[model samples]
Structure formats: C-alpha cells, structure tokens
Target: MIEANKLKMQLKCPMPKLDFDVITLGHGSGGVLTNKLLDSGVFKILSNPLLDERHDGALINLEGKTAFSTDSFLVSPIFFPGGNIGELAVNGTVNDLAMCGAIPKYLSLSFIIEEGLTMTEFWEILLSIKCACEKAGVTVVTGDTKVVEKGKGDKIFINTSGIGSIHPKANISSKRIKIGDKIIISGNIASHGMAIMSVREGLQFESEILSDTTNLNHTISALLDTFGDGIHLLTDPTRGGIATVFKEIAQHNGVGIDIFQSELPIDNQVSNACELLGLDPIYVANEGLFISFVDESIADDFLKTLRNDDNGTQANIIGTVVETHPKQVIMESVIGGKRVVNMLPGEQLPRIC
Candidate 1:
C-alpha cells in the first residue's frame, strides 16, 4: 500500500517540457511554419482586402497631399495598466499624422518577436492591433513578422507606418503660431505615464489610476471640420510631456509661450503617485491628449466645441503665445511666480512609449 501511494504521487508531480507551446525561430524563416503562423494567427484576425493580397508590399492610392509617419514602440512590460505595445503603436502613428491635420487611413504593421514567447500572448497582441485599427477608423493593410533569439530582445516590439491625407484648407505649421495664438489642451495630462508607473511599483492609493491610451483621430477630425485653417498647430504630448511640447513649438515659432500652473489639469490619483515618486506630472507622458494652438479670436468657440467631444471634456486653455520671452516656455506658478520650462534633460522614464 505504501508503494502504491508513492507511485501515484510521482505521476501527479509537475515536470518541465522538452519543448514549449511558444514561438520559435522557425516561425520567421518564411517556410511552411511561417505560413502556418500567419495563416492561423495574424491574418485570421486582421482580414482586409489589401492584406489578403499577401504581396511583398502594399499598393495604395492617396489623393491630394499625403502625410506619412512611422513609429516603433518598445515600451517595457509588454502590457501595462491601460494598454499594451500593440495599441500604443497604432495610436501613436495615428496621432502623429493627426498633428499635421491629416486624416489617418491605412497602416503597415511589423513585429519583432522574441523566441520562447507564448503564442497565446502573441495572438492577444495581434487582436489588440486589429481592434485599435478599427477604433481609429484605420486599416492594417500590410504587416511583417520576424523572430529573434531569446534573451537578445524583449518579448515583442512593433513598428507601424501610417498614411494619411492632409486636409485641403489645413495650413497647420509652427510658423503660423503668432504671439496672439492661444494654447488649448484636450484633457488631463500625465495619466498614461503615471498609470504605467503605478503598475510597475505596485502602489496602493485611495483611487485607481488608468492610462489614457486611446485614439484621438475622431476628435481631431472634428476640430478640422469646425475651424479649418484657424488651427495653427497641433501636437500630442507623449514622451517629454506637455512641457516638452511647449518648448519645442515655442522655439520653432521663435515666440514665448506662457501657461498658468493653476490651469493645468491633473487627476488626484495621478498627482499622489507623482508626489510619492518625486516626479512632476508635467514632464510625464500622455497618450490620448493633444495641444492645439489656435487664433485668439476663435479660442473660446474652439474650446466649447472641443468640450462636447468625449475625450476633450476636460479641455482647458492653459496658455498663450507671448512676445516677451522668445523661444521659451514660461509657467506662472500658483504662488504668483514665473519659471522657465524646458524639454526633459534626460530620460526621465526609460522604456516608456
């Protein structure tokens, strides 16, 4: 009876597999396995006519002036509080074109997958990419996949190339930003960066923080429909945050920009997280927000219209371009003092999208 019990225990013990249900180098070798991976996984979800063609490259037609942008997403932790690298890649590329007053249309997705990553995780990311494209009113018309040896690369990296057409009357440019131009922000800043940090640090707060990782193309298109060329400049504050965007445009237009710290929008939870980390929310990142420079005369009209949009409900006119301090960003402290805001000196958060 003792020997029978011992044999049953040995049968129930867990053991490591000689092989795994994970990605392997052969999946990228353009052989039978490559076709199976593409056929059974990626293409199964992202089914569109152009991608179905399976040509070496996608053939597309663009009318009028087309703006093309490409971005590579290498955010650490693959998945974060609000989004993963897949959604970030899609939204990031779409926002880049939107900043130029373009309507995003199609995209090409490419991936670098590390060996030993689970196929289940890869398929989840693929589905994420598909959903993001649909939400943005864009299509993933082409894609490529490559596999790297384990330990040499992260679990995954994504590269997205987007094509969009410039609006006919859209003459957005830094040169169009004059001293009288007003700066309007879409929503509360720093939620995205703080959300990522919150997950990484495992901090407990009174409230939960979620990343604002979403697409803004619809709202931006509405802005174009409302104010056409009255919009002077548009930018999404991502890596270096609102302060960095202000400094770049201020310098590019050779004008001074002043923002009231009291007017800056921030979430209470994100604020607490920032304070605990000794980080300033202004220099953090954002995913679903943007800054608009518009003519001073129509600033109120633009603000009201933007407020009606789902994402821009928290919109605020944070600052205006001024003639006093050329090529610099000045922030008016809540305590009634002014200070210069510059681009982030170095990498504040590494592997942050």
Candidate 2:
C-alpha cells in the first residue's frame, strides 16, 4: 500500500518545454548547457528560498541537538513499480534522519546523469524529488550536478545529505536496549526487494508488487512523541534486511535476539515471489521498513499505536532481546524448532537502494 503523506497534495504543474530533448555531455560542463538545464528544470521545480540562492553551499540555523545523514541511490531500473530513484534518494536520507530520532528539515541533492538520458526522464525525476521533499517536509538547500559518458554511468544516480533537529524526548541508542526489550517492525518485510526482482526477472503474479518506498519520518516522529525514551533504538533494515540488522545489533550490544517465524509479518505475494525465486524474504533488502527496539512494558501499546498509523497498518512485534545465546539471533520456527539467523554471507541483491 502507498501510505498517505499528510504533507503531500496534488501537484498541478505541467512539464515545461525544453530547448533540448536529451542530455548531452555539454550539460555537465558548468557552462551554458548546464545553466540552461538548471534554469528550465531542476531550479524551476525544486525552487525554495534556500535552493534559489544557487550558492556553493547552503546556510541554515539549528537549535539544541541535531542529526545528520547522507546516502546514495543506484537502484537498477531507476523507475520501479511504486517509485523512482528521485523519491528513493529523498526518502532514504529523510528516513535515515528519522531513524536517528530527528525531525528532518533540509537536504542537499546531487545527480550524476548519463549523457543518453532523455530530458523527459530527467524532468519526471525532478518532479519526484520535489514531491518527495514536500511529503517529507524538507527543503533542497544546495547540490551539484554532473553528467558522465554513456558507458561510464547508469541512467542516473542520486546522492542526498540531510540534517534535522533531534527529538527532545528521544534517547535512541543501542546501549539503551535491555534484555527484555521488544522488537517491533513498522510494516511487512521484503516488498521492496521482491518488487525490484519482479521487474528484473520478468516475473508476474496475481497483482503488481509495488515497492514499499514511502517516507517514514512522520510515522517515526509520532512514535517518539508518545513513547519518548521508552523507545530504546530505531533502525531501518535497508540493504542488509532485518536478519542482518538483528545480527549486527545482537553482536554489537552483546545481547541475544529471540524472534518467532510465526509472528513475522510478510505480504503473501512477496513471500510467494521469494519462494519461487529460491530467495529467503528475511534476507532480502527493504526500503520503507523499520525495526524498533522498545521497552517490554510499552511493546503492546507501541504495536497497537503503530497499527493505527497509515504507514504501519501491518506492524508486528517480531522479536525481543534475550539473555541466552548472547551475541546471536535465534528464531523459533513455525513448527517447534529454532534456528540461528546470521548476517548475509554474500550480496543477495545489487543496485537496490
């Protein structure tokens, strides 16, 4: 499901006519072509007071504690079922800040475009970026753009850096996690990875599998607002999937993780696709899912509250911190068995943001 963004509304702008149809090497030269591209496209759609300055860097103010994060997007087939590289880049950085218990405020967007990419494609991407920033309630402050030869780059790659003010009540840290803390997942698992795989492998199911790429900052903010320091640690299982994230946390914090296969939430289509592809959904990458380690006392309330939110209708209490088998993750099977969950030994998917 595409979770509704309280900040996003219908964008009524139409694409502007451009002098050129496709990007050329000259567009990256910091000369006339580059200026024209920015004037007609990037600057026009993403215009804000700070981005309008067109300076080498942006200036902004901050109070109290702050959180900063940066990430790059290179998802193959930049346009996926539910989103494109543009929004993916924005959501990635914004969610990164959210994971740190921050209210995201500003972003720096940079694009590396291949010479052969069409202007139409570029404009759609810019529109996505604008919509994503608006939905996340953030602004594009400063950025750089460069073009590469056809073979030197994929269609396009984006990098975003973001900063935000930390939530006053948030005390998110691994060290804060305790033996009885409950692990709650924001939504279903493996949708994003299976969505990409469906496109790459030309597999079709009863319905289209859309990427779960929506921004999670708002959802996270609401949780922090209510739970405060009761929320110990927050993390999004992006490239490495939840298993790897749990294993890392378990080893790093010297605690045992106990999860149940029966309680793990996953989409029917995603699970079927993973099975057909001989892939384990638990090891697949995800873009819009987050795992929260919260105090056991508040776990039931946390899961109930999360389930009411649009972004977390499918939330589940998947696991808990334990004292046995320290530095390891153990999952009870649907049958009466247990298995060790470890870090992914090799790359399961590539070019997936």
Candidate 3:
C-alpha cells in the first residue's frame, strides 16, 4: 500500500503555470523574458544535445555533399483536415532536402507571432514541430521568435531551414536527365490543393478530401537504396503542380516530355471537384507527392519499389522524355491526340500551398 500512497501523492503535485499566459513584444526583445520563454517552452519540448548547447547557432558535423533548404509556411487556414501549419513547415523543408537525395539531419525554426495570439495555440504548434521532427528523424537545433502587431500578421507564420547529408550514389538532378528517361509520379494529384480550395470556397462534394501532406524522406530513401544513382531526377510538384514542373524540367534538361492522360492518377472525387470548380488536377498542388525520372531500363524496378511502399501504392509511370519537341511538355489526350502543355500562362490557384 506504500506504493499506492506514493502514486496518490505524486498525482496531487500541481504543475507550474506559465508566468505569462500570452506572449508580448518583450518575449522577442532578447531580454530576460525572452530567455524565460525559450527555457520554459521551446527548450522543454525540443530537448536534445545540440539544442541544449544554448549557443547562438548549432554546431553539427556533416560529411560529404550536404543539402540545405529553407521554406516559409503561410498556408491559409493554418489548421487543415490532415495537418496543421507546424507539420507542413517541417515536412516541406524535410522533403525539399529529401528530393536532393539527402538524409535529413537538422532544422532551424523561427516563428512570427501576432500580438494577442493564444499561448495554448503557440504551445500546440511547438508540440507538433517536435512530433514532426521525431517522425522524420531530425532535430530543431536552434530558433528565434518575434511578435508582430495584431493586424500586421496572421495568427502565426513559421519558417524552417533544413540541413541534410547527400548520399554518394545520389546522381539525381535536372541537368542529369537524359533522353528516354521515364517519369513516375508518386501518387494521386490535386488532393491537397482541392482540399484547401474546397474548404476555402465552401464547396461540398460526394466525400471529404483531405490534404496529402506527408514527408517523402522514407519513400525516397527506399528508392535510393534499390536504384541508387539510376534515379535521374526527383522533385515535389508544389505551388505550380506537375504540369508547370514538367515544363520547367523539359526546358532545363533540353528534353521533351509526353504525359499520357490515361495514365494520370486522379481520384474520382478529386476529378469531380475539379470539374465543378473548372480546375485541372494536373495543375493543382500536392504536398505528399513527388515526380521521379528514372532510366527506362530500370523503370519497372523503380515502379515496383514504390508500389511496395504504403504512400506510393498509387505510383504510376505517367510519361516519357522525347527529342522532338525539345524544351516542351506534350500531353497525349485520352482519345489519341497530343497537346502542348505550356508553363501556365498565369497562376491557376494562388496561395493554395
């Protein structure tokens, strides 16, 4: 019964309350209060050897070619069906480095908070950052915070900079793409953009469309393990989507791309949503997907590899590189004709990411 009595006493111990319930300008003033905020909140949640060093910048040892990337998250409706801004911020940067064939290592986060933002909400986002880092096997080694006037900002904006070590066998790059390289898309398109658009425009369809926001690090790693440098290129089609990305790739690599409409992976609900909104799925945003260009000889090997992955079950060989229409993307119509898929004349969906 002594153990039971000890458990009861431990439960009775009260937790300490935050000294200030809401953040103020002073928290960003680099004074005593700022240190308190970091110690009590950021440090408490993101406990790690590098972060606890308490230096102005983190000292990390990365050998070989290191990939570095940074991004800022201003996604509207910060909280979405499948994820919040915190997860998006971490995943986006992590995936950027992964696209470069890097093993993600560390991240630096900064928050731009609006005055009067709830303390609870701020802590919630921090906790999510921690969780995303854990899931991706990365760390937030350093950070900064600033408070803006209420009207000058949304509730909060997050910026993350990531560092990773590129594998020696990763020969993927826009310039490395060659003629006859096959293009493989990781999964269904337009879900993320449609998810945001549907909620923002108050359009209800047959079913709920959730954002496909996810980290592609593991999937890419699996491919690299199997195919190594045979994978010629990797890219996540974000703001401008696959069409725009394909056009840029064709232009940069001096190759023409032919995408087949019949091979495109479009969910029925997403296709219907696009039809109702006068949108095209190929030109919509996707957070959890990526495009891979592989040597035609091993294309099936890569496809089988991705198919074995849970997130890439819908992976499909969507197109091929051609020499005829150099620096252009041509889409073969379902009925058996071809059309030039130019870089979008203008933005189709703004701020969807």
RMSD to the hidden true structure, all candidates: 9.1, 1.5, 5.8
Model 1 lDDT per residue over 1-353, tens place: 12222433444322223234788999989898788788777787788899999999888988889989999998888887777788889999999999989999999999899998887677667767767787788999989999999998899999999999997768888889988899999999999999888888888777778778878888998889879999999999999999998898888778999999998899888888999999988999999899999999999999999999988999999999999989989999999999999999888888788
Residue 17 alpha-carbon offset, candidate 1, angstroms: 18
All candidates: TM-score: 0.93, 0.97, 0.92
Highest-scoring model, lDDT: 2
Looking at model 1, which ten-residue stretch has the lowest summed lDDT? 1-10
Which candidate would rank higher by TM-score, 1 or 3?
Answer: 1
Worst 10 residues of 3 by lDDT: 1-10
Between prediction 1 and prediction 2, the one with superior TM-score is 2
Comparing 2 and 3 on TM-score, the stronger one = 2
The lDDT of model 3 is 0.85
- The residue pairs found clashing in candidate 1 are none
Tens digits of per-residue lDDT for model 3 on 64-162?
Answer: 899999999888887776777887899899999999999898999999888777777777677667777877888999888888887898888899999
Please list the residue runs of candidate 1 whose C-alpha ends up more than 4 Å from where it truly belongs after superposition: 1-20
Candidate number with the higher lDDT (1 or 3): 1
**Which structure among the candidates has the greatest TM-score?**
2
